[model samples]
Target: MQHLSILPILLPLFSGALLLLPPFSKTLKRQRLLAVLSMLLQVVIGFALVASVQFDGVTQYILGDWRPPYGIVLVADPMSSVMVCVTNFLAFGALCYATGYHDRTGGYFYPLFMFQVMGINGAFLTGDVFNLFVFFEVLLIASYALLIHGGGKHKTQATTHYVILNLAGSSVFLFGLGILYGTLGTLNIADMAQKVGDLEGSVAILAKIGALLLMVVFGMKAALLPLHFWLPKTYSSASAPVAAIFAVMTKVGIYSILRIHGVVFGDDAGELANVAQSWLWPLALLTVVIGTIGALASPTLKLLTANLVVLSAGTLMVCAALGNEAATSAALYYMVHSTLVAGGMFLLADMIARQRGKAEDRFVVAKTMDNPIFLGILFAIAAIAVIGMPPFSGFLGKVMILQAAHSTAEQLWVWPILLLSSLGALIALSRAGTTLFWRHSSSKQASDEKQTIHLGEWLGIVLLLGASPLLALFGGPISELTIDAAVFLHDPSLSVDALLTSPLADGGF
Candidate 1:
């Protein structure tokens, strides 16, 4: 079971490497088969890891038989394991969608996709702060390639800005790591958590600054206010599958904040306990406000979905800022709901674009689609789920967040902003849906061009969209898991003790 901790990272790494080799490299069919099989295996392995962690508690895999506070380790607790499971599930759906035409537009699409999954899994599983930085770079490098896979002037321009900003963020991340390591003397996260409360005077000041710098990097990754201007264009410009998979990338930042700030600098840390809460609360609220406005002003369905992603990020940040187990649990639930729904929305928008001829996904009247009823049904389901309507997991997720906020001082602020944002999202999405499906131009000539809808694409959309109802139906057990995970995260001793004292494993937990 301990060995399973590393498979999530390794499966994708080796699969991507193999996909770049001869037979797979020359044949798209072979590449698709390999990628799908790898992802299917990943989903199985991910669930196994989650189940093992749930049954056995925290499990750590020591590399080279080395011990913690010295050697590299991969730790699997409830939260990280669940995240891996969710990521693999989403990756599978996105890969299924991409096998249609998105993969054909560029070389190494399958390989790059696998590499991106490897990086994300590594980030979730790694127990060292420095290793987190390494995984961040891995994911970012792969994403840069994936974003421009189709090759267009607009994509090039978006990628250019995305690269510049992330490069700057990466530099800041390294500086923060240097300062933290210099002051703390160890980059192992469990070790850092143990030692953080012992610092004094100048060293403590430096550590605080370093911690906040890391927070800045995380906020940028989460697309918090003032740093979120690049997201809508970047996401809207990408191909459907790329955009769909990119939905989970922001949660990576949210996870980091929970792992580092929530655990390392938690209530137990002297002077640094909950250091990020003050700034996070206000900035998170502002992010919701601005993101809601952006969504309302969006002229295209894809752009609107991108803005909604920003809004969801802000909502998740609010939960993080609350600094309680309830909030954390709610954040986890909402995170999953938002990622799946937003991804479905992106794919649905792309389908609409394909059917609309020159009108694309823009909110404008165009010739009626070849299959309006079918596409309309998908769009409505996606819109209802994304807008937090009842019977869908999104509504339940938002309610959990609101309930978590109740009795807190920030409730007054959080309730208004979050509810208002939902209202805005509803208005914008309703307008887009009506414009695309209701108002039609009979005067325009019927389109001679028709894009083929692949079976894989339909299954992909169903799998992702279908998650909403499943999550809702099983909300009880899943919520219990998240609640336990949140409690586990708050108490760092469980992780530290497990990492430090667990006996060497020969494929047994």
Candidate 2:
């Protein structure tokens, strides 16, 4: 039971390493089997982690017999455990979809995929800020390779820009980390939370600047305004499965802001309390506005879907900026909903592109699809889910966020902007669906190239998109869980005490 806390990171680590060994390395068939099995186990372990945290309050797994504020630690709280579950479940879908044909694009796909999952899980689980930077690089390096797996000029070009921007961001992250360590004398998140309030004058100013720099890095990762130009092109250029998993990548930044800003600079931090909200609020609104406009003007389905990711990130940021338990809860529910649906949209867009010749996912008239009715159904459900329509989880998530905002002074700005952004997403997706499904040319039909949709593809799409309605179906318990997670996050003392005060007497297992 205690070891379950680390399995999410360890399973992927071991699986990825095993894939590099002789028998598995030589055979793609073997690789696929192992990767799929590994992902399934990861999903199970993810669920177990969530359940463990639910039953045991905050579960801390200290490494190397050392206690926190000194030793490396993996803390599985309600929020992080749920994020681990979402990442594994999403990875399972993306990996399944890749095995369909995309994995065949390169020999190392399975190993790289496993490493990518490992990095994301590590990012979610690590309690130390330095390790967060390390995990960020781990995922970024794997993603750089994955982005170019299929090998296209556009992909290469996009990957190049992606690599450069992130490298710069990584450098800035180090600068911020250095400043924080120098000023606060510690890098553990819980320790820093304890130390931040007591700083005054020069040291406090340095700490504040360091925090803001880190926020800039996080904002770039979340695809907030002015730093978001890389997202649409980068996402649209990748293979479908890679793009699908990348949907959760943005939420990693959202999670960071929620964790760092909420716990470290929270209202209890005295002088540093709510330091980020002033900056986060206006930028979040601009992000939604600009992102919605991008979606409206997108010329392709993948691009439009990518912009919607930006829109979702902005909306989540708004909730984070509000900085309350209710707002945090709303952000959690919406984060899961948006990540799943957006991933499905990317997969759906790829399917549509495959069926449409010459006009591949672009908003141009081509012959009707092989299964217009079926694709139309999926597209409609996706649009309704992403656009916040009734009976789906998107609407419910947005409503919760809106309801949470009512208590904040920013409700006046938050309500109209959020609702209008939903309207904008609705309009954009409706136009895209109509263009892809209804507007077909009669002149020259598509060649008799029969595209066989694989069962794995269907499984992947259904697993992700289907979660939307199911989330709405089981909204009560899920929302309560999120609220509890929010409450846990708002109180940093619990984490500090769990790690530092009451550690196990025996050495870490």
Candidate 3:
């Protein structure tokens, strides 16, 4: 029970190692089987871990039998658990989608995929700031490898820029960590949170500066405005599954912001009240505006790249500005929805490109809806989910954010900007959709022939798209869980009391 937190990190590491063995390399069929089975196991374990956290409130696993403030710790509060589930689900879906494109790459896909999962899970579960950095590096390295896996010129160019920016970000992150450690004398997040406010004078100011610098580093990773130049090029150039996987990578940035601001910085609206309301709010608005404009201007599937960046920015801004229970809940909901929809669209694009032969394969609009009905349906679902249509999870998330924004009616600017950005997203997506599906195909070949959707691809896309509704249905209970999660995050003392007062065997929170 104490070691449950390590399961998320260890499972993926173990799988990656096993897949590298000779036995698993006999054939592509065997590799696919192993990948699916391993990912399914990961998904199951992730859910179990989430359930355990809900039942126990907050579960902490001390490394090497040493207690925290001395040894490393892995904590599973509701926030980390939700992240674990989401990372693993996206990983599994991406891996499944990669099966069709395996021949395009090689035998290295599964191993790298597993390593990517290891990094994401490690970052999510670690309770130490330095370990989080280490995990981030691991994930970034895996992503770099995957970005340039097939070795095309476009991928190479894209990856070069991606690597350069991220490496610089890593340097900034390390410098900030050094400043933080020198000032605080500790790297453990729990201890840092407990002690951060007590420091005085220059040390305290330095700590705040360090936190802000770290935020900038993560903001780049999250594709925040003014630091997001690398995203469109890199995402558009990478393979579909790789781009799909990268879609969730921004969540790492969001997770860091939430953790630092809400937990380490302490959730007093008075302490950093002006900073949150002024600087962060205005910056968020800029991010939303820039991202939407980027989407509108992009001509190809590249537009999704900018659109996702915008979505991430909007979600992060809402979470940062609102900083209420409802805002955090809304951010989490939007994060989950955006990750799924964005990833699905990438995969759908991959399927379309595959059917069309090459990137340069002339754009051919589907004359009969039946010709590309499967992908058409997928595109529609993803588009609607992204655009925040009714009954979908995105709508629910937006409603929560809007409610929070309205609470601060004094800040009259929030609603209009949000509304305009929503309109911008609709227009950008409509144009992209029109170009991809409704526009007449200039190529006569498509008119003379019909392409069939592969059963595996069809199944994967449909199931993935259908998951949005299932998430919506569970919204109520999940919201309750998120509320509990937010409470625990904002005040861990409440969590400690809940855990101690409840019976251990029944896993009561």
RMSD of each: 1.5, 1.4, 3.2
- For 307-409, candidate 1 gives per-residue lDDT tens digits of 9999999999999988888999999999888888888889888988988898999988887887789888888888888888999898999899898886756
Worst 10 residues of 3 by lDDT: 500-509
Candidate 2: lDDT over CA atoms? 0.90
lDDT of each residue in 344-397, candidate 2, tens digit only: 999999999999987999998888788889888888889999989889999999
Candidate 2 deviates by what RMSD? 1.4
Better of 1 and 3 by TM-score: 1
Q: With candidate 1 superimposed using the best TM-score fit, by how many Å does residue 106's alpha carbon deviate from the native?
A: 1.1
- Each candidate structure's TM-score, on Cα atoms with residue i matched to residue i, is 0.98, 0.98, 0.92
For residues 1-509, what per-residue lDDT tens digits would candidate 3 score against the true structure? 66678878887788778778878866777777888888888888888888988885677676675556566767788888988998888877777777776434855787788899999988888878899999999999999999998888998898999999999999999998998899889888767766776777777778877777787887887877778778888888877778878888888887877777666775532233223345567677788888778777776665565465665665566676676666777777777777877777777777766555433212445433334666677777777777777788878777777776645562476777777777877887777677666665455554444555555556556656777887788889878877776777666565333323334212321
CA lDDT, candidate 3, residue 504:
29
Candidate 1 residue pairs in backbone clash: none
